[model samples]
Target chain A: EPEVTQTPSHQVTQMGQEVILRCVPISNHLYFYWYRQILGQKVEFLVSFYNNEISEKSEIFDDQFSVERPDGSNFTLKIRSTKLEDSAMYFCASSEQTDTQYFGPGTRLTVL
Target chain B: AQSVAQPEDQVNVAEGNPLTVKCTYSVSGNPYLFWYVQYPNRGLQFLLKYITGDNLVKGSYGFEAEFNKSQTSFHLKKPSALVSDSALYFCAVSTHASGGSYIPTFGRGTSLIVHP
Candidate 1:
């Protein structure tokens, strides 16, 4: 079975520094999404991307966060300036026709 | 708005016993419910989903869920539990919006522990 793949399984960055998390969704998937799970917290939706534009975003996805499908295969989430609270396990998911989403192993971001 | 609730924070069961992780959801329209499992340091793995089908939906790893429309619940169940099944389980719900499918809302995960 094809699975979503993410690069840099663990990321450590200083506060106020920019960080980009990369993911390669399933080959034929259309819709992509980003979610974050804080330690001991529920998974929170960050943003959804379709057709190279943001389809939906949560209040937690503020001005500092941006997503890009720079290429046919790569989807990236860029945080302009990281905060300590931003440290979490970031997951990338993709689906065909918005039915069932397949998730990647996730990138653990540690902001210090 | 769509929301999912996993009432229990943790459920402990002995190996070879049946186990259940309860989940309830609220949605405006028809619901698309799903169950996912997460191992330590791993991503969410698709367990099963209920989308306008028979109430009982079978999924991967000998697991199944029964969707109760009247009760608005989709609870994950496994007949015989294994130690490998110990993981964090999450329930999610989504519904159709104006244009297309709505973003899924996940419940706070329930940790399942199977003691040998």
Candidate 2:
């Protein structure tokens, strides 16, 4: 079965540096989402995208975070001025409709 | 806001025995319940979903779940446990927010360990 794919399975960056996590959602998916899980914590929603615009975002998705469909298949999450608390496993998910979402393996971001 | 609660932090079962991972949900409207599994170093995989069904939903890897609306719970079950089934399990509920947007609220996750 087709699945969501993410690049740079692990990312390490210095504090205050900019980082971009990339994802390629399933080809035919209509809704895309970004979520993060701190070690030993529940997965938290970051943002959702549809029709090339943000549908909703959580309070954690503050001014530093931005998402864009840079291309037909590429979904990117950019964090400006990363903080230590930003270190977590970031997941990308997509759905054919808006009901069942398939998640990617996730990118582990380590900010120091 | 929609929310999912996995009451147990961990469940231990012996191999060849039955296993159950509990989940409960709170939603404003009808619930779309789902179970996902995560192996170490791997992404979360869809196990099954309960969406306006007959209350019993079977999914991959011989796993199944029952949806109870009255109790507001959807718990995952496996008739026989395998060591390979040991992993982190998460329950989620789908709901619509303003502007007709659908979002999933995930539980904190429960770790299942099957020992031989």
lDDT of 2: 0.93
Clashing pairs in 1: none
lDDT, each prediction = 0.93, 0.93
Error of 1 at A67 (Å): 0.5
* List of clashing residue pairs for candidate 2: none
Tell me how candidate 1 scores on lDDT.
0.93
Chain A TM-score (model 1): 0.98
lDDT of 1 at B79: 99
Model 2 alpha-carbon drift over 4 Å, by segment: none
lDDT of 2 at B94: 84
